[model samples]
Target: MLVLGIDTSCDDTSVSVYDAKENRVLSNIVSSQYSFHREFGGVVPEIAARKHAENIDLVFEEALEVAGVGVKDLNLISVTNRPGLLPALLVGLTFGKGLAYSLSVPFKAVHHIEAHIFSPFIGSEPEYPFIALVVSGGHTLIVLVEGFGSYSLLGKTLDDAVGEAYDKVAKLLGLGYPGGPVIDRLYREYDGKYLELPKPKVKGFNYSFSGIKTAVRRLVEKGYPAEQVAASFQETAVSYLIGKLKKALKETGVRRVAVSGGVSANSLLRERLKELDVDLYLPPLEYTSDNGAMVAYVGYRRFLIEGEDTLEVGALARCPIS
Candidate 1:
């Protein structure tokens, strides 16, 4: 089956064509709006939505062209319709619906986080009854995955997501937008000693990054070196994430774990995960961010199990995976 996936969950306009029969992604095209949101130091919802509207069509065409497929050849159209910026989600959802209607194919509404959960298993089947740690710009949560279409929300952020905390800290340290990569780079390049940041004491598997972010701000206000502050913050944040994952692994007794979302691409986090004595799955860098490949792959899997969604389904700004 040929499935076309569209995802405009945040600042990226991504489109992909997945060949289910071959279990491979034919094409995955992403157009990032980093340049537009850079000066603002973060994503502006209105600007992201506008850019998605302007870019989605061209991205869709390019995806199909690269995949060597035609609209008529696509058997299903999958789109991210929930748990994202409302305006941005609507742009992709509306366009996907139109294409599905024109081509007379099934329309599938995919959950953004759920797509991230299975991103690493795109070309291969995922082992069931594992743990999923999803960390990203807009979300931070852990889940117990029993099987396809079966998920138990383990815990999530009570405040800012980890990636958001990174961005906020970077802005405080005079770094540019899309903070993760730059901060990661600084953490490696700077030999400056890091400040002692407090670890948030959130109960259970839940996370709280707002406290860490505020602590970093105070250190910056105290005139600490920017590189030291960046290094300190990154170390603390990534350690916190790993600490929680360890807790979850021990408590749940799940031996297999998969980490997804943009933050999963962190070098420190990846290095730490390798130290654990359990099976680990991480998506290639391309699938780490908000992209259509994972969305399309999950859509195809969900469609096989739950069939298609009604055309009347609407976009949602906040939706739970449970």
Candidate 2:
């Protein structure tokens, strides 16, 4: 089956063509609006939505062209319609619905987080009953994946998501927007002593990064070296995440683990996870962030199990996966 996937969940306008029959992605295209939101030090919802609206069509066309397919050849239309910026979600959802209606193909609405959970298995089948750590700008969650479309919410962030904390800390250090990459780079470059940061004492599997963010703010105010601050923050944050994951592994006794989302692209996190004594799955860098390939892949899986949705389905700004 040929599935066209569209995802405008946040600052990225991504589209992909997945060949389900062949179990492969034909074309996965993501047009990021980082330049537009950089000046603001973070994503502005209105700007993100506007950029999605302007870029979705062009991205769609490019995806099809790269995939060597036409609209008439598509058998399914999958789109991210929930748990994202409302305006951005609507742009992709509306366009997807219209295209589905025109082509008389099935329209599938996918949950953004659920797509992230299975992103690592885009071209392969995922093992059942695995633990998933999904970290992104808008969400940070640890979920138990029983099977396709079957998820158990193990834990999530009580305050800012990890990526949000990274951005906020970067802003405090006068670093540019989309803090993860720059901060990660700085963390790798710095050789001096690192600033000490506090790890949150949240019980269970839940996480809290607000305290650490504040710690970074105080250090910056004390005129600490920006590189050391960034390095320290990255180390502390990644360690905190690993600590929680280790606890989850002990509690659930699930040795198969998968990590996904934008924050999963962190080099430090990847290195830490690789050291764990368990089967680990991490998405390719291109699929680490918001993208249409994962959305399409999950949509294909859902369609096989639950069929399609009606036109009455609408976009949602907040929705739980389980």
Candidate 3:
């Protein structure tokens, strides 16, 4: 089946078409609005949603053109439905719903975070029963995915997500918007010992980054070098993530693990997770961050597994397979 995926979860206006039969990304296009939102320090929901509305059609057309497919060729329609700016979510959903209805295709409402966890399996299908560490601007969650449509929420963050930490620290260092990558670059130049940052003591699979944020803020207040503080912040963030992944691996007993989200593109996290010696799965640089390809892949796969039947689907801000 050919599936079309739409993702307007945040600042990026993304669309992709997947060919499940061939098992590959026929087309994946992401139009980032970072430049528009940069002045705001981060994504402004209203601004982001409005931008999506303006560009959604163009991005949608581009995806189809790149895929070399027409709407009539698609058998399924998928859109991220959740845990995002409601208006942004609606932008994609409304368009997707209309497209599905017009084409007489099946509509699959996907959870934004779940689509992130499902990212690694795009193109080449990975084995099931793996651990998923989803770190993004708004969320951080470690989940146990038994299979498509089946998952358990093992743990999450109490305050800021890893991406949020990156953005905040980037702002402190005068780095522009979408700070994760920029700060990661700075981390290589400076040592993070301007002040010993503390990792939050989270219980079980749960996590907390608020304390570290406060620590960084205080360091900035004390007049530490911006680069050093940025470096230190990056170090602690990567260390904490790996530490948590190890904990989840040991506790969940899932030797296969996957990491997703905009922050997953961080080289440090990628390198650190490699040391675990597990069947580690990560999205290619292209797939990392918010995009529609993962959603299309997820929907297409589920449709294949279920033989074209229907199930309950909705735009859920908090839909956990668990």
Candidate 2 local distance difference test against the native: 0.94
Q: Count the backbone clashes (under 3 Å) in each candidate.
A: 0, 0, 2
User: In terms of TM-score, which candidate is strongest?
Assistant: 2
Give the per-residue Cα lDDT of candidate 1 at 247.
96
Candidate 1 residue runs with Cα over 4 Å from true position: none
Q: Model 1: per-residue lDDT, tens digit, 48-150?
A: 9999999999999999999998888999999999999999999999999999999899999999999999998999999889999999998899899998888
Candidate 3 residue-wise lDDT, 1-322, digit = tens: 7889999988899999988888888899999999998987898989988999999999999999999998799889988877688878888988988888888888877778778888887878778899999988988899888877788888999888889988988887778898998888887777435457998887988888888888988988998888888888888888999898898898877899989988999988898999997999999988889889998887676666664423344555555546
Candidate 2 wrong stretches, greater than 4 Å = none
Better of 1 and 2 by TM-score: 2
**Every model's TM-score:** 0.98, 0.99, 0.94
Model 1 Cα shift for residue 112 (angstroms)? 0.4
What TM value does model 3 have?
Answer: 0.94
Clashing pairs in 2: none
